[model samples]
Target: MNIRHYFDLCVEAGGQVFERIGLTDDYRASRGTGFFTAEHHIRYYAETRVGEEVSVYVRGVDRSDKVVHMVALLVNDTTRRLSCTLEIAAIHVDLRTRSAAPFAADVATAIDRELAADTADWPVPVCGAMGIRR
Candidate 1:
């Protein structure tokens, strides 16, 4: 799959999480710019063919007042193999000031709850500082 397709999967899965915390419509309506990606990383393990059954597994890796980080694993269902992994750090922002904005108390609390629940069953380690030596 292309890079955009991978990103789309991440967004869709992340949206579900946000929706549960009551940040869906509000986030969408803030079209002017509500959030920005601070970092995004992807690692590929295998290729997936068209029409193949697959699943995207999302986990909340970490979060703060204005930032949330997540990891998503794309797996081939039939073979039960990993296809790729995506890590993203997104920050809430204020469009007018183009600056970070803290999430609401409820939103922050909800995120913490989600993180705890998701972390309990996390399947993969959320990697950091990836690279290779020649």
Candidate 2:
């Protein structure tokens, strides 16, 4: 599979996680705020060809005042092998000012809750310098 596919899959999965953590676009839009990717690290472990379906698993890894780090895993269904891992650090931004901003109280609490849950359930792999950046 193309490397771009893995990136897209990670973003797709991250979007879902954002929604699950009460960070939907609509909510952000109402507040004139949004999340912008500040950094990304993709670790390729295996290759997949066309017609090979994969499943994506994602979770929040960590967060700072203005940034959130999330990790995504893509696994080949048939082979049951890890295909790729994408870690992204996204900044919460104020749309009008176009600058990084802290997340809302409710949103921050929700994300923390989800992060705690994910941390309890999943073994966190080393996310590298990019993840540590935030």
In candidate 1, the residue pairs with backbone N, CA or C atoms under 3 Å apart (3 or more residues apart, or in different chains) clash, namely none
Estimated TM-score per prediction? 0.82, 0.90
* Runs off by more than 4 Å, candidate 1: 27-33, 119-123, 130-134
97 Cα displacement, candidate 1 (Å): 1.4
lDDT of each: 0.75, 0.83
Residue-pair clashes, model 2: 1
Q: Residue 60's C-alpha lDDT in candidate 2?
A: 77
TM-score of 2: 0.90
Specify the highest-TM-score model's number.
2
lDDT by residue for model 2 (81-112), tens = 98888888889999999999988898889888
Candidate 1 residue-wise lDDT at 80: 79
TM-score between candidate 1 and the true structure: 0.82
